[model samples]
Target: MDNRKTPIASFYANLQVFKGYAEKEYLPYTTSAGDVAALDAALDNILEEGIETVFARHDRIASAVRGSAQAYGLELFLDSDRSNTVTAIRIPEEIGALRLQDHLSENYNLLVATSLAQYADVILRIGHMGENAFIDKLIYVLSIIDNGLRDLGFAGNGDLAQLFIDIYKENI
Candidate 1:
């Protein structure tokens, strides 16, 4: 409820897990002489699994929102008892390290309808890197913020939330 205090601890905790995974499994395979062929195969597997995990997580949260919406109606939107909604964009194979790096600058968004679907009342997320150095780290934290605030309806300061919602609506 303390929106004034950013979720730094939560962000760091998720970031560490993401960093460890990259250091242990992702980095060596990509940069070192540790079996490039095997590493490439593993990377392929990770990507497939990662994409699946992202969507599954989002679906789960969305479902919760729908349930709450049915029970609580529009009041569900302002409730604090819900989990956060997080939607991950599909990562294309063509996106290299540099593109992944730049993606860090873009804000991620998920619509209120997603939360309304499950009656979840809240949304949350974790982001893993694409292909660049510490890219996953940045994504992990940003996702936390994106989904955290989205659930809380605190995505932006003042009218920023309305502005973002408008943009999101236009794009969709």
Candidate 2:
């Protein structure tokens, strides 16, 4: 049997060739020039801000999000292995994930992700990554979530936006 002729092996070989081309500033396929320009701009911004500072900002934003979730008496899906970019929160049974997501979208023009499969109705995912990892943007998102939950009859223990701001300030 020629193992190298297998589909997986062929795919790997093609991937290697593509990588080699990329290393030499060549593309064997068509790519969106606008996307490449946008990526270049993003890279330039990150370089100007310093990668470490960008990482620290993400960390601070994540901490604030988690703290605000705790203050709202919401349970985190992953207690320890949580991500620095997205936070998975277990929504209250009465709230309904779709309801919360729709409320935010319809009322505030904000979109939040709902979990998949069996957990879809119970989990809400909030992303605080890249450009979304800023304090002002996070505060607005938290406020919208707080208002949406309140409108939906979920009584949170503390003000979500205020708690997020407090936690963010503490981290800074």
lDDT against the true structure, each candidate: 0.36, 0.88
Model 2: weakest 10-residue lDDT segment is 1-10
Highest lDDT: which candidate? 2
Clashes of each: 22, 0
> Could you give candidate 1's per-residue lDDT for residues 1-172 as a string of tens digits?
3344555467434443354675466542234556677688767966876876654544443443233223221222333443334232222224322233333334343222222233222321222223311223333443434344344333233232233333333433
Off by over 4 Å in 2: 1-17, 23-25
lDDT of 1 at 11: 44
